[model samples]
Structure formats: structure tokens, C-alpha cells
Target: MTALRRLVATALLITAMAMGGTAVAWAHAVRVSADPAPDATLATAPTRITATFNERLQGDFAAMTVVGPDGNLWSDGTPQVQGATVSVGVRPLGPAGSYTVNYRVTSADGHVVSGSWAFTMTVAGSGSPGPSATASTPSADRALPVWPFIVGAVAVIALGVIWSRLRRT
Candidate 1:
């Protein structure tokens, strides 16, 4: 209930809120759309696979690969980054099963975003499969979770409240 203690508690609460807001603001480019589309079933295979993100992406460190059901890489040459779209040439598709598209791209914020999605091919193509995907390409399972930071901020605010109450008694 003291003036100094109240000021300190207010400062902590404000700091925690500011940090949480910042964490939410810190974001990477997210895929807003795709060529074949996620989980889409296609009767005909497309020559190129493209993913459009929500924001602009960095031209450097952008890579994408399309893997056929045969477990071989079908992507040809290098992946291209144009504004928010990232695409790569597919060497025709093989097998009628599901095909996976993996991508690792740098966001305008300079953080790397990576993920994968699959689409089913109803009919197989005549083109041969490319070589297996190499480990050299950067791929990430997911982006870093922000829950921990939020939890920590909540804990700090809770502790501040508890300390203020303890000081009153």
C-alpha cells in the first residue's frame, strides 16, 4: 500500500505488458497461399510449386523442394523469391500418392521460416524422380514457441502482487 511499493509494482506490470506485446509483434513470414495448395488433390501435376507468404521475404537464404511419393526430390534448380512468393521448378511429378513441399525462407525481419506441406496427386506423371533431398538445405521443424516468455512475464507479475501483499502484513 506504500507509494514506493505501488510505483515499483506498476513499473513491473508495465514492463511485462510491453515485453508481451513485443513478443507478439515479432513474427515471421507465414504462407498465405500455395500453387497446388495444402492437402489439395490434383488430377494433373503442375510444373512449378509456389508458396505465397503474408509478408515480403528476403531474397537470400530462400530454398524450396518438392518430394515425390517415391521419396526422391523432384525440385529442379534453385528456389526463387519474389516479394512474398517463393517458388521452384518441379521436374514433373511421379507416383499418384502424396507429394511433400518443403521450404526454408528468410523473412524481411531476417529470421528464417521453414515448414512443409503435402498435396495428393490422383494420377502419376511420366517424368523421372530427381535425387534424394540433401541435408545441406536448411529446414526447420517449426518456429520457436513464445509461450515460455509469456508464462515468465505472468509469473513475474504474480510474484510482484504476492510480494506487495506480504509487505502489507
Candidate 2:
């Protein structure tokens, strides 16, 4: 009976620890809201696109691009970051189709997050294409390597196994 109790307690401990680690991993910055919003259909083109995250962002590292339906870039100039919000100016939109907004930002915790969203304009504009939609690959310094976390999880499981064996002895 005592052995069964020990086993149950150990299982609970492992489960709790795993859940805690997952929560911490997901505590990084996440998009809370966006201007024009995801999948929104608008009658007029917005002059700017904005993304709001759950945490403050690093201004210098925050970047965004607006892509038109013909695979041309409509975003102009560098993106501006204000606290948890990042925005970039958009050219007068062209074509009445899907436009994609791609953004990358560094959270206060120093983790980089990147994502894309699309919105449709009901009417097209006569604006000229700016550039092509090309996202810069995340720099090595900004990349979050997973090897360390894998090593830590393995070490934890190994320690748990050793503890169980020692307890049995």
C-alpha cells in the first residue's frame, strides 16, 4: 500500500512539473490584437497596419510588412513600436484582394516572435507596388534553440528514475 502511494505521488509530481514547464514556455509574447484584424474585409485600405502583443516589445527589433495580392509589398518605411504595439505605414493599397501583413518582434523577455495575417480590401487603389514580400530569416542571436530545454527535461526524468530506484532499495 505504501509503495502504491509512493507511485501515485511520484506520478503527480511529474505531471505537475511538466505542466509548469509548458506554462513557462508559453508565457512568451503573443499577439493580443491587430489593426484591420485577422481576416477582416474593409471597404477602404488602411494607411497603416498595427499588431499588439501581450507584452512590451523592443522597438528596434520590431518589423512589419504589408503584401498586396499581386505579391508586391505595400508597406513603407520602418515599423514603429510603442510599448506592446507595433505598426508600419502602408502604401495606398492596390487590387481588391487578399493582403498579408507579416511581422516580427522581440518581446521584453528577449524572445522573438513572427507571424502573418491577411485582410481583404473591397476596392482596389491605384498605388504603385513598393517591394516584394521577403521576410528576413531570424538571426542566429535571435533564434531560440531547443537543445537546452531537451537536455533539462531528460535530466529531470533521469533524476526521477534514480530517486524511485533508490527508494525501492
Which candidate ranks first by lDDT, i.e. highest? 1
lDDT of candidate 1 over 1-169, digit per residue (tens): 6999999999999999998878635887889999988999999988899999999999987889988787888888899999999999989788899999988998888888888899999998888887876643445534568899999999999999999999999
Mark the regions of model 2 whose C-alpha exceeds 4 Å error after superposition: 1-25, 135-169
Off by over 4 Å in 1: 1-25, 134-137, 141-169
Backbone clashes in candidate 1 total 0
Go through the candidates in order and give each one's C-alpha lDDT: 0.87, 0.86
TM-score of each: 0.69, 0.67
Model 2, span 1-169: residue lDDT tens:
9999999999999999998877656667999899999999999989889999998888776778888888888998889999999999988888999998988888876778888899999998888988666543223455668999999999999999999999999
Cα deviation at 100, candidate 1, in Å, is 0.2
TM-score of 2: 0.67
Model 1 error, position 169 (Å): 37
